[model samples]
Target: MDAAIEQPTVARLITAENREVPVSATLRYRAHDPLAVFVDFPAEAALDGEAVTWTFARSLLDQGLRAPAGHGDVRIWPYGGTRTVLEFHSPHGLALLQFQAAALRRFLQHSYQTVPAGQEDVGAVVERGLSALFDEV
Candidate 1:
């Protein structure tokens, strides 16, 4: 049988206006290391080349959020699901997306504790992933 880590999955990045961005995303969970995702975009008008990649780790997301308490115009949880939802506001519009993270959770659980393993532990996984691009969301 093929190794699970060698496999990849798809996820949808949605917007408030119903616009969306489909991403080829993956996760890697290394022992004594942090949790992170590798996102690849297939050439789109809003984004750059087909090789446009946006990668970030779980620690990065955990440290950046102050939600339910964040005094701002938005909130998000990027690493909070097998099928995760990322919702945040942007200068152009409200950007939101739903993604598959089951493989991600398996990878991280191999040696790290990246995503919360509960139906209600979602915090700010999505906002952190999108914050690098979107402004003030």
Candidate 2:
């Protein structure tokens, strides 16, 4: 299984005044199971990095897309970097979480590869991804 997602990556929250704040220890997702993501932080954390998980179910995830919101907006790969970005906007502010592309791909390859392109549902895709991780190499 990929361990990178479990590691403490930096979670930055950009305020209205363009200030960066650390709101969580790490924003984690297990395989393709966005719902299984663990958001470790305070309720009063001010910003939300985990909201990106909802985008998968909401059909808002894309390589270079932004969804407008009240506070800021959600953006994915705004810079077209090697890393996949998940940006979340809340009434409080914006949260940005970066994921290493390689680890993320490995973590979810089974889901994306096994399912027909466009036929992926959140749960089945995630189950396949997790099974791949648990399966022997």
Candidate 3:
């Protein structure tokens, strides 16, 4: 008997938005799966820092990626000050997402500025950003 192997799905990097920040800043995404996605933004563009790196990793785990279908989990890791890893896990399989340093910075800024009122969803802004990256708009 022959064993079948599942091929790893290639994740696509997407830019949600771009702006000049005395340099340049952008919001990007890499889809790990239908349930999980990765997001990135610049920390400093000129020089990525630890705080910026940590914030982006935390936000992706704390926000961004979600299992709208209700069947997966998103995981994140900060790689030095240049990148963040987002992983999605489900009964079916796993997916990995990566974000650029600049994009992550922009995302963290947007995420912190907006806070929902009582009974309102706080994740709406993040969701919209993700949707934009996915071209769901």
Relative to the true structure, how large is the alpha-carbon lDDT of every model?
0.44, 0.48, 0.37
RMSD of each: 10.6, 9.5, 17.2
Residue-pair clash count for candidate 1: 10
List candidate 2 segments past 4 Å from native: 1-53, 57-73, 78-81, 120-137
lDDT of 2 by residue, 18-117 (tens): 7766645444444445434344555556334332233332223323323222223655553344555567666655566555544444434433443334
When 1 and 3 are scored with TM-score, the better candidate is 1
For model 2, name the residue pairs that clash.
Answer: none
Predicted candidate 3 versus true structure: per-residue lDDT over 5-41, tens digit per residue: 1212222232234321232323322222212223322
> Can you list the residue pairs that collide in candidate 1?
13-97, 14-96, 14-97, 77-124, 77-125, 77-126, 78-124, 78-125, 78-126, 79-125
Q: Can you tell me which runs of candidate 3 are displaced by over 4 Å?
A: 1-72, 116-137
* TM accuracy, model 3: 0.35
Q: For residues 24-124, write the lDDT of model 1, one tens digit per residue.
A: 65444322222444444446624434444444554443333322222243343544434545444546464455655455445445423332434222344
Q: For model 3, what is the error of residue 132's alpha carbon versus the real structure, in angstroms, after optimal superposition?
A: 25
Ranking by lDDT: 2, 1, 3
Model 1: lDDT equals 0.44
